[model samples]
Target: MPVTDCYTCDREAEFDQLPPRERIGHDSLWRVSHATGSELLGWLVLVPRRHVMEVADLTDEEAAALGRWQVRLARVFAQELGTPKTYIIELGEAPGFHLHFHVVPRPVDLDPELRGPKIFGYLGRPEPAESPARDALATRLGAALDRLNE
Candidate 1:
């Protein structure tokens, strides 16, 4: 059951028309999108194709695919951008924001002050990376994901 007001559901419904950044990569059970309104370049969001509000709601296959995606995205970021670590978080607190996992790259030079949960300060901040830049990075990352899928 899809929620009419859900952000992820809204995007999922427009799968065919979504921009490259919004459909970076996907399998039958999940989709990856570049995080919008954020300065973080490689920040990606892994979302279920169907509407599910909690981890318990996920099917066994969905849960398995979710872990694989997180690992693959972390590996890609490490190989391509040399991010020492990646942060995976899920906080479905907002109204329209449904259950989605945030895979954020934590570079070696990242300010120690913004480590861990505090790194969220990078999101929703002023001066987010522009659309073209996001699209380019998404395209690059998407291609990397494609190669890995091979």
Candidate 2:
């Protein structure tokens, strides 16, 4: 697919201008957090700061750092959220030219049918939730990131 304007850049811009949320944390090139309470499943999004579309666009330093950050965040989520495994996904199909990774936590007892590549099969579309819920989740995630710093 053709690359589009970077959504990560837009989000970073908005996040930087707005007051800091209690749920997010600074992890070098990206922000880390569990998904809002809407899905209590411990979903996380690792967004890059720059407006790059592919991994190839990342500098050697960024490439090396990305792996370390992913592993570290996954470890924290597993310990704090009781997740058995984490799924790191990079689907550049979206309009955002920036590269972001999805660090989805999975429980060991989770249904096999909904496991792996088919986790979101039933939830065909993103549900519309209240803004407060999102804000709350962001706050919680930000706090979690803070803990990781210590």
Best by lDDT: 1
User: Against the hidden reference, what TM-scores do the models get?
Assistant: 0.94, 0.73
Residue 9 local lDDT, model 1: 89
Candidate 2, which segments miss by more than 4 Å at Cα? 1-4, 17-23, 33-41, 94-96, 122-131
lDDT of 2 by residue, 1-150 (tens): 323465456566666564333125664566664443324345666766666778888889778878877887777667666788888888778654467777777877778988987765524345454556556655665666567778
Across 2-120, the per-residue lDDT of candidate 1 in tens digits comes to 57877788888989999889998999999999887677777889999998888889999999999999999998898888999999999888765578999999989999999999989
- Inter-residue clash pairs, candidate 2: 23-139, 23-141, 23-142, 23-143, 24-142
Overall lDDT per candidate, in order of appearance: 0.88, 0.64
Q: What is the number of residue pairs that collide in model 1? A: 0
Name the lDDT of candidate 1. 0.88
Residue 48 deviation, candidate 2, in Å? 0.9
What's the C-alpha lDDT at position 73 in model 1? 94
Which 10-residue window in model 1 sums to the lowest lDDT? Answer: 125-134
